[model samples]
Target: MSTKKVSIGAKPTNKPATPTADAWVENRTAADAHETMKRLTIDVPESLHRAIKSQCAMRGTKIADEVRELLLQKYGNH
Candidate 1:
């Protein structure tokens, strides 16, 4: 399986302005507004739950992140 490279806590760079900076800010704000998180609860079999817990423990990630990644991969980003 391929792994994604993520910068867990990278700082944003302070760079010189470009002509499209205003548009970039507007678009990013709009995207952020629409991307708010919501809570979800689901019931799964005990074995499946154990597997999820095991995978998360091995990878040093939470079950929620793993579930979200799997869902986003199986279904198109909505």
Candidate 2:
């Protein structure tokens, strides 16, 4: 067998180092909506934080749902 020293710049690239935006997310249909959930984040002052937690427990639901309901009530158009 013969030995060969390949050139340093001879390597080939078939793709980009970073993917396009479309590659990051895929299109979804209504069928997928039932299987997926979204998350949101918010910051509250320490004084009223416990009250929010208690309200969530009273509603027998997650803190996220409680917050969403409150915002919808306050800003219905949005």
Candidate 3:
């Protein structure tokens, strides 16, 4: 297979990397609201908490989102 090499100075396509403000506003619906929000407090070792926080920062997301994603993957969003 042949590979195409891009020039170092080439500009990227005209596309937004992430969702735009308009898209975010339009895509958010009533179902997205935290209607059944509940507090989940747990005690963990300081090292574990620090690791979780560091991973969350690296992924540019909140601990809550990371935990929710894990829960969704394990238990599903039923």
Give the per-residue Cα lDDT of candidate 2 at 17. 73
In TM-score terms, which candidate is top? 3
Our model 2 lands, by Cα RMSD against the true structure, at 9.1
Candidate 2, 19-66: lDDT as tens digits: 665554443323425543344567888768888788778878887666
Give per-model CA RMSD.
16.9, 9.1, 12.1
Candidate lDDT scores, in order, read: 0.78, 0.66, 0.80
Higher-TM-score candidate of 1 and 3? 3
The residue ranges of model 2 lying beyond 4 angstroms of the native Cα positions read 1-39
lDDT of 3: 0.80
lDDT of 3 at 36: 50
Could you say which candidate leads in lDDT?
3
By TM-score, is 2 or 3 better?
3
Q: After superposition, how far is residue 75 of candidate 2 from its true place, in Å?
A: 2.6
* lDDT winner, 1 or 3: 3
